[model samples]
Target: MKKRSVVSASLLALCLLTLSSFSTADTLENIHQRKKILIAVDIGAPPYGMLDGKARQSGSDIETAQLLAKDLGVELEVVPVSGPNRVPFLLTKKADLVIASFSITDARKKVIDFSNPYGVIQVVVGGPVKQKIGAFTDLIGKTVAVTRGTTSDMELTLGVKEISGVNIVRYEDDATTNTAVSTGQQDYIAAAMSVIPAVKKANPSRDVETKFIMKTFPLGIGIRKNDPELRAYLDKWVQINLKNGKLNDIYKKYFGVSLPADMLN
Candidate 1:
């Protein structure tokens, strides 16, 4: 009887140990089995994400995504997602991650998870230098053009509704909105300040310039809500890169200015 009991106990212990080991293996495999990370990029947002003239990927977000995939031991697939469909692509699992300039919002958080902000930029209303709007209140009765499906569009529309008499025009991308403002077809344009330098550089003769105005909000990388484990990995990875000065180096290389200490600290 004693011998039989010992044998049964040993068998139970072995099964439990095997099960435990399998669970651990499965968790690690989950992370590693993610062979390729699909990233979304807007071929429009410069200094953060954009496509080169030949349609090659090159930008801050591209470099950051590349380094992140390297750290995560995965290949990167950059998916071109414009403002309108970026979130839809992420929600549908067409992309594993979105390195696009996605802003973290309470409304957005309900659908997706955001990493700690990798970078921050203010959004402002821009117009021809002569008719510059000075503040959000000044925009109360004006027609504002914002990129469709972007936080800027949402925020400006909400702001307009709150203030009343404000009209919003949505475009598919920044370039179109900028062109609308430059041509006087739109009263004002809303976009990120990080884009200001590049847009001004691209159209020095347009007489277009940004007004301080009200801030839109900071931005962050977006991930599917089902992938908290992956989201946590990216959040920590961003901190690691920021701590080691890798993030700042990338910033300086593209923007020609060191990142603010607050971003790293």
Candidate 2:
């Protein structure tokens, strides 16, 4: 009787261990199970994702996210993320995808997959209104602030490094980086033209003006490398959004201009 009782306890222990091992859930599976989709947003990046005076979210990416979720038939949940942590959010399962003006690059592609480029964003160099810097070559020997982990950072770093004396100051978010330049702490800030108007509004007396420096690059949604199905869904839905004029309307509403013809395709 003692041996039989001991055997039963051992079997029960094994069952419990098995259950515990299998019970820990996968994030994507949990999301699918719950019938919801999570999209990461950079609330600090205006004209992309930011709170208006009413505290409600409004931006190009916010509107795009809503449309994407509607077409996906999943509940949309926006997960706010900063510049440096956006990829971490997606990798850790906090966000199912990122629609936050993320650029497509080979370095980023190693960690996360991206859909075909939906649009292109022109990167510009801005300085205090009195000190307008027009060219990348001119940035040498100057201090420039750029958001960490962005293509702008990479582009500027490449330019700065090539010149022997330039200094690159990196920040984790757009607001801080903008503050650095507008407050006269940094000489210039590398940023997107689409979002500059909103930043200008935030700092009314900064006397800042921006100049177009480089042509824009492709922007696309980012997902984990394993999520091919999700990426395909996004690719198809973006096409639909373009055809229905939703993408163009969103761009015009935020940027005050229609998207380039190539951007729609």
In angstroms, the error of model 1 at 96 is 0.2
Q: 1-265, model 1: which lDDT tens digit per residue? A: 9999999999999999988744421212443677877788876778677778897878888888888878878778888887778889987767777887787889989987788888765777776678757777777767878889787777667666657777788888876876676566875677876655665666576666787645645568887665656666778888898899997788788778876778888
Q: What is residue 69's positional error in candidate 2, in angstroms?
A: 1.4
Clashing pairs in 2: 129-207
Residue range 57-157, candidate 2, lDDT tens digits: 88888998888777656798999988889999988888888989888888999988888776668877777667646777777677778899888888777
User: Model 2, residue 60: what's the lDDT?
Assistant: 86
Q: How many angstroms is residue 111 displaced in model 2 relative to the true structure, after the best TM-score fit?
A: 1.6
TM per prediction: 0.80, 0.84
**lDDT of model 2 at residue 208?**
64
Cα RMSD for predicted model 1: 8.5
